[model samples]
Target: MFGILVSAFNVALGFVLRTVVVKFILFFGLYFVVQAFVPVLASLLPKSVDIAGLFSSLPDSVWFFVNMFMVTEGIKLMFSALLTRFIIRRIPLIG
Candidate 1:
């Protein structure tokens, strides 16, 4: 009985390491790679553009329309992504 328990424990440990540890490592590896490139991508945006002034110069009517559209789309997109992630994580092995 002791030997059987040891063998089962070893198998379970192996499975956990293979799946959980490997996935954790891969996710962080990718995350770091993306993080390292963020500054480079950010540098590509125009630094000379006065974003605040540009927005302030827009007419109130147009600004309200644009603001409402952006807010609506952003909420919809964020909610959809969060819901999908929540559902995926609740699944057995797919998460």
Candidate 2:
């Protein structure tokens, strides 16, 4: 049935698309955490690292933002995979 096949194909494609979107959103979220929290963490440090001063080193741009977004996405996926496995192993789910 072409209609059934088309519906199934759309569902499958949606799943695939969501996977990619999740990667990008999660990556940006992770990077946002790092960007926001690192300074707070640095404040607690002994002050030699000067990370607080490093924001000036990076000029804000479309390129920087996008590259960091991609890198952050990879980091997010890595951690999310690890965390999901760890939690799934510990928790039981009911259908």
Candidate 3:
């Protein structure tokens, strides 16, 4: 019973650690890669556009909700890709 409990604890700890590490890598890796395009994206915007006015029109609550939703979706998509690859590799016929 003790051995079984130890094994189960090890497996859970391993999974938790793997998840944290993978999420950190995926989040920051994608963040830096996307940040590299900031200048190009900025240049594409028309200089005459009123950026401040555009943001000022929206309520703070709306902005907060949108940002939260976008962040949640992005993380979910990134993790899903990792999970899909894991699933694909586990298929006996695929290997």
Candidate 4:
């Protein structure tokens, strides 16, 4: 019983450390990258049109949602691939 409890606790702790913490760090890193580059990217667009007006037309919520979605999907893919590799390594002999 103690062994089982210890195993469960370890698994939960590992998940928090490996998945949650790592994902949070990666998400913030990606956000900073985007924030740093967005102005540069915007400047690259053709200046004949009113880019500022187009950007201002959208509500802050829309940009937040899009950014969240992109970061989440990217993290999901990265985590899935990492989990798959872990599982593969754990497989008996075949791994």
The candidate scoring highest on lDDT is: 1
Q: Which candidate is the best by TM-score?
A: 1
lDDT of each: 0.75, 0.65, 0.71, 0.72
Across 1-95, the per-residue lDDT of candidate 2 in tens digits comes to: 99999999999999978898887877677667556765675477574755436545666784487476785477669977875565345333311
Candidate 1 per-residue C-alpha lDDT over 45-90 given as tens digits, one digit per residue, 9 for 90 to 100: 5689675686688898997987978955776799678855754564
Residue 16 in candidate 3, Cα distance off native in Å: 2.2
Which is superior by lDDT, 1 or 4?
1
- Summarize candidate 3's per-residue lDDT along 1-95 as a digit string, tens digits: 99999999999999988998887887676567556655665577578957558757888888898687785477669967875575445444453
Kindly indicate the candidate among 2 and 3 with the higher TM-score. Answer: 3
State the TM-score for model 1: 0.54
In order of appearance, the predictions have TM-scores of 0.54, 0.38, 0.41, 0.46
Q: After superposition, how far is residue 85 of candidate 3 from its true place, in Å?
A: 27
Candidate 4 structure quality by residue, lDDT tens digits, 1-95: 99999999999999999999998987677667656665675577576966457657878889797577785477669967885575445444336
RMSD of each: 7.5, 15.2, 13.6, 15.6
Compared with the true structure, the alpha-carbon lDDT of candidate 4 equals: 0.72
Task: Rank by lDDT, highest first.
Answer: 1, 4, 3, 2
